[model samples]
Target: METVRQRQQRRQSDAAAHRQRYTNNPQLHKFTLKFSEDTDVGNYFASHRIDVTNSTICNHCNALKLPTESPGMCCSNGKVVLMEPTIPPLLQHLFTSQDDIAKDFHDKIRFYNSAFTFASVGVRFDRELANAKNGIYTFRVQGSFYHRIGLLLPEAGSNPHYLQMYIYDTQHELHHRTNTIPNSNLNPAIVEDIKAILDEVNPYSINFRYISNFPEEDIKNLSMLIHTNIPGLDQRTHNVPTAPQVAAIWINNNVPPGAIQKRDILLRTRMNQLIHISEFSG
Candidate 1:
């Protein structure tokens, strides 16, 4: 029977411990890779020098550097792969944004070490799905995600950092973002690349983590904003829409003429899938 204060203390202690671990070992946690076809994956990996070999050290070390008829690319290490024409940054930002600025809506997020930004990532094969095809493979990429959290009470102590886990998925969040935005073009090449990646996945699980860094004062202001219900707080009528509703309305109102015409394209694509499934029988 832990009291609320005791629980808070425990959480603080745990957060401190997590931060300490991250400081000692920094890594990447949340990341994505997008490509249209098998060739694209190969090219990206080749360009990045991503090695698939199990040996930690290069066996051929200096042998491959010499000019010879049969020279070997003895680079035993490489970086993670990401296609150039993947989802644009806007959608990525939107996916990772704090939609409501003043809401008391905060989720516990973690960071790796003391880094405030992303860095090099490594991969670890958790388990391979037998269904890998078209350049898509279901495997875990080892990376570190970091967040620096400030205490609700500044006097309470140091802000904690954390390192979190990452799991991969092929559903491709880019499509969802493109669908939601008005007047956005669906590039066939990009779509094909995304589809190719999606086809490669037969995932056992995909974890969605919402993590961010914020200060204590920001938390208080957010709490006040949410508690006050500023979206509905109109000096005259008190009938204003909430923050999210306002955002939706703005998106609709600001849609370009071209976007309106193409708006149904994504919707139709989704509906057709549903219709096909509904018509199917076991």
Candidate 2:
């Protein structure tokens, strides 16, 4: 196992070698060495390269996952319902001053976690495909959401997100993502305050999961905020949702999607059969 100090030294050596390779190539340097922080942060990151504080659940701590072992041994797998609801910080200073810990965090591009990712939208239902059992439709969901984008609001968009900021390309594409979100129906004060807390160019949000059937067209980009309770919010490495609250999001489904407009009698949950209580079912 490599010690942290040894790892740092190796990283520095690797970076030096990389720069040495590009030093003679002026044109390539002009293209790649654009960001002032480029040398500080190289191209790729391994799973181990991620700092201890970044991952909410640890494969080792929670599940005892080993480098040699496969996943799915514990809650760290990220598939099960989160046992603990310790959601991480919404924001961190990417440009840290002269502190070792801060430098260590920022050195690895900590802001990248807060940065947005592309999320494809649009879901179609195809009965023809369903009939053949080849899968109902072509889920050709494209377009990154401007809102604190998907699977994990950090649920994780925007075209390329604010990734171009690192390279300083896509000048025209860089714009306020939340600006496109319709907020006429929401509390402008909350929105404004949250927006103020966020960087206009690179926004970050806590993860969100909800059970509502509200369509994207109906609610628009502000869906995550609506479902989550952002009050003097609980703070942790990863601010997790409260357990009962999260459970309610799914369990209390009075109605299930069956038909276009309740026309499908086969699928609709009748009032009596809506919920099956163990005591009442008997």
Best by TM-score: 2
What's the TM-score of each model vs. the native? 0.15, 0.17
Candidate 2 lDDT, 1-282, residue by residue in tens = 999999888977986686566555556423322446546454543445534443333644465334544565564466675555433243343243556544543553323233333343324332332242332233332233223212211111433233232222223322333332334222333333333344332323211112122345685533232333566665553464443332123233566566324221111133312222332221
Misplaced by over 4 Å in model 1 are: 1-3, 6-177, 181-184, 201-282
Cα distance off (Å), candidate 2, residue 161: 13
Candidate 1 residue lDDT tens string, 157-215 = 32222121111121333343234223444443443433334334412111112222333
lDDT, model 2: 0.37
Cα RMSD for candidates in order: 25.8, 27.5
Model 1 poorest ten-residue lDDT run = 108-117
Overall lDDT per candidate, in order of appearance: 0.35, 0.37
